[model samples]
Target: MTAETLTVVDTGRDKKREQGQAELVAAAVEAARPGLDKIPDPVEPDGDGDLTAEEKERLDTCIGGVELLSTAFWIAGKSLDTMAKGHLIRRIPHKLEPERYYETIEEWAWLEYGIKRSRCAQLRAAWALGEVLAARGYHAPEGQVRELVPLKRKYGLNAGVAMYEIAVEQHGADKVTAQRLRDLVKLLPEDLALKDNDDADQIARMFGGVLEHAEPKALSAGGAIPTDVRRGVDRRALDLANVLNRRRIPRTEVERHLLEAFADEEDTTVFDAVLARMKENKGK
Candidate 1:
């Protein structure tokens, strides 16, 4: 046989081998993935119409099954990380351009489930947090760690990490249950002002009364401000209150200061000024 013919045959064989390997990998992933019998059919009416009886039944069944499965997984101490990763790996190959599978598991989940990518990511993070806590010897109750996932997002990753470390060190893994962890996270110093104090328990109790009274009211649907924006405001207000309490500023005085500040300026400028003042005072 000619050298040219031999070279062409070798290249063809290599291509076939690569294709076979890809197919095998895809099949293995698919086989390992959770069965889809648990997921409900996604078909529904296109517009502002109600679902048909069949659709409604399917939807209800799906939701119920999902809730049951979720609770079961949580109770069984199964990590959502495993589920999320397996789902992405299994489904990515089915896409027309599988090369884009590396984008993000959350994005892939959105494509597959039609849920918001951010929500999917939050659940994934919760599960991952559970794994992290477990590995750190802090074995919280089955679903306890997951409950802190939203707080993790709210407080920021660095804050969450610091809280976990501090909780483990101060309270010990056994003592840091879900509720205790929540309380501990709430007691985290908003800024660097009070971090020098090692008494998390004392700090939590000191601010607990103020925090209880400062709970944000439910936002009305017709309100101009978005829920997230309102939550941000509430968080800032809480932070300010913490700083004030740390400085031993009386509640009535803090209220008077806010009234004066708002009377002068109605915008976020007032908030910024107050926070700056509080931080400055804390410095002294």
Candidate 2:
């Protein structure tokens, strides 16, 4: 009331701040609204989707009521680390777990926005790719999103996105359709299919011509990876890393209790060596 009664003047700073806030909110909404289908069945939310104290404040204030849910978004820092966690932190209010407030995303979306579950899924997917689609004026959106779903399912989300970018580069955006994207992902070597985010990124840049091809002596050295090439060392490292991302077997369980996690005793020595090397690398 006091602010309304008083006239305020700005020296452009206010406008810039407001614009920044608006952009953050828009990006947050997109990140948070991942497809309903993407949610796990048992729904193992990251760290059980625990809301930080800051997140709790936003739920109460930003989404003050059902009326605000559709239009409002909470601010979360948009870093690469945070991006992977976009769906995890943003949508906890909708999971149907008792401790988590016993609401389903389907019902929650319906109650807040009057949108169907399927429509929510599509909107979630589209918004997720907003940046990518924005480049082409979002031409042929339906066809684009349609293919993205399958690509995401086959290779994890990051890999799918890499493939999409590669597809756009190889085949112009105007011609890049659902079928075209499908054929591109299929063409990826089997060894490359399950790539982690970094590997996917390098491949995307290499294929998309963003990465300069370094070939003075051998022109073709900068291009194409064939199916038969062995990825023995790198692939094994990635597989091991993925396993380690989950629960690591306790040393006490393996050494003291003599668990069969490793069939051979020599493998235990190898694990110790790998851990030492990892620690050494981290320091550097």
Over 103-221, each residue of candidate 1 has an lDDT whose tens digit, in order, gives 56555555665547666555556654555555555555445665566555664333444456555666676677667667654443333233434353444444454443432222232
lDDT values, one for every candidate: 0.56, 0.49
lDDT of 2: 0.49
TM-score, structure 1 vs. true: 0.32
Per-residue lDDT over 220-273 for candidate 2, one digit per residue giving the tens place of the 0 to 100 score? 111463433334433544565477793223212223222343344666865576
Clashes of 2: 0
Question: What's the lDDT for residue 179 in model 2?
Answer: 80
Error of 1 at 75 (Å): 14
Error of 1 at 242 (Å): 16
